[model samples]
Target chain A: MTIVSYIFLIIGAMFFLLGGLGVLRMPDTFNRIQAGTKATTLGAFSIVIGVIFGSVENHLDWIPKLIIIIVFIAISSPIGSSTIAKATYRSKNIPDNLVQDDFKKRGENQ
Target chain B: MKYLITFITLLVVYLFLAGFVIEEVILGSFVSAVLTILLANRLNFKVDWHFPLKLIKFIFVYIPVFIWKLILANIDVARRVLSFKIPLNPGIVKVKTNLKGDLGKLTLANSITLTPGTLSIDVEDDCIYVHTIDVKKSSKDQNQKEISGPFEKILGGIFE
Candidate 1:
């Protein structure tokens, strides 16, 4: 149990580090936010799953809580990231290298 | 009927989240009922009458695909980050989907967001704006084939 959890923990930490690197390396807020959200969602979820398996199971309580955390994160993360993207676009902080702009048509229609 | 279903669903979720504690369960049950009523319309609460058989298929099939994609997504992102050159050609490209149901579209959106290089920006009816980091020259065809097409293919069987 410890070994499996540790492996997952290491993988999660690696993903988290990658996400941090992505945020630093990406040129714009949009790219940074996307990288951060994607990596962190998976990263944190793996860590939670790892913990669910690793910890001493005196009672079977932690499993459900951890599962709920994963479900909650899965449902909410994309929505949150999309919300941030919407706000960033609305504020007109367009990235210098932004190539296409299809989202504006809907905004204009509104 | 919908309210009852919503209440029960929320109650179950509440219990799961609270981890079977007596005090938490009691308090959460009341809160769940209240919240269920408060957010009923937003929830679009409905149980498909054909749920059982479809759900069995979803569990057996779709889950494996989703899990596979989840693992691949993390690995892909990690690779992108570790690569020496900052490989980015980010753009919000318009892509169209034929998926009709809310659940199918939502699933596709979440899947796209979770997958590497593609982030779902907006879903307007049938059109989705996807922000991708790296764009291949044949990106138009590639994005359709790789990103939205696979999920949409499987989801059609489930949702449609």
Candidate 2:
């Protein structure tokens, strides 16, 4: 169990690192946001869940709180990202090399 | 009926969040009941209420699979980020959805936003505009296979 928890934590950390890297490497705001949100959300989730497993041997009481956090993340994180994306669009923050602006096509400027 | 469901849901959330103490549960239920009665008309559920057994199935069955995909997505993004000069052809593509209810559309939109390489930008009618990290990867067929195909099946069952 300890080994498994260690693996989860390590992988979670790796994902978080990769997400930060992706943010730095991506060319534009939209791409950066995509990379940053998707990777970090999952990274945070994995890390928390990993910690739950790690705590199971001695700190079993913490498990429900961790699950609650995970559920909160699962519900809230995507909505948060989508709100950011919508804001970026409304602020004319579309990426320069973006192949198409379907919002423009759809005339959904709010 | 809708108000009752809303009250029950709020109570459950309250119990989960408040650590399931008897006092907390009772207080939360009273608070939830009042809130639900006050807000019930705003929910706009015109149809007669039915037991949401399929929705329970969706929560239990579909959510675990969605989480698995999310893990895969992060790994894929990490791989792409770590790779050298893998040309990212980012673009907005429209995907068709068959989900009937407002809740279904909202769930599908949120699902796509969190999944690999796709961010759901807007939904106009039955079409959803999604920004992809690699447009080449999210061709129409792939969109059906990857994005909507997974949840659409169970969501259809639940929301229908």
Candidate 3:
């Protein structure tokens, strides 16, 4: 169980690193948001699951707290990303090289 | 009905956290009742006889698929980020959804954001504008199918 938890922790750390790197490497705001949000959400989830496994051997009481944390992250992370994406779009900070942009065609931003 | 459901859910969660001690149960009931009375009207989703069935479907069917896709999404991100020459053909494309309910649309948007290579930017009328890391399919219908096919189908069953 400890070994499994350690493996998950390592995986989670690696994903977090990837998320940071992606945010730095991506060309524009939207791409950075996508990379940062997706990678970090999964990274945190993996770490929480790791903690749950690591502690379940000691006591069952910790399960609810950990589960609540997981649920909170799952609910909040996507919403946060969506809200940021909308804000970025509204601000007209979008990239010119977008291969397709239906939002522009719809005249929603202006 | 909504108030009752909210109160019950709150009480259950409190009891789960508090381990059903007598004092905690009484306190939880009081707090849940107060909260339900105050907040029930803000709870948008309707609860009916079908709620339990929908909940079961959400847990048994929807959760597994979401988790699987979440794993795939992380793997996709890992691949994109780790490559020295990152492959990206990014775009914002519109996809129409058949779901009418707000909750259904919200779920679809959130799921799309979390899933592989797609992030939902805006939802307008029956169409969602999605930011795709790779613009594999240019047609709107194909984009709609590729992005939200399974989610829309399952969520339609649950939320609609």
Against the true structure, whose lDDT is highest? Answer: 3
Two-chain DockQ for model 3: 0.76
DockQ of 2: 0.64
Q: lDDT tens string, model 3, B3-65?
A: 778889999899877775799989999999999988987788756788788889999989999
* Model 1 residue A92 lDDT score: 82
Worst 10-residue lDDT window for candidate 2 chain B reads: B46-55
User: Which runs of model 2 end up more than 4 angstroms from their true locations?
Assistant: A108-110, B33-52, B137-146
Total clashing pairs in model 2 = 0
lDDT for each candidate structure: 0.81, 0.81, 0.88
True contacts kept of each: 0.75, 0.63, 0.79
**Candidate 1 per-residue C-alpha lDDT over B60-104 given as tens digits, one digit per residue, 9 for 90 to 100:** 877788778877877777777778876778777788998898888
The parts of candidate 1 lying over 4 Å away from their true place are A104-110, B21-47
Q: Is the docking of candidate 1 incorrect, acceptable, medium or high quality?
A: medium
| Candidate 3 structure, TM-score to reference | 0.92
Q: TM-score winner among the candidates?
A: 3
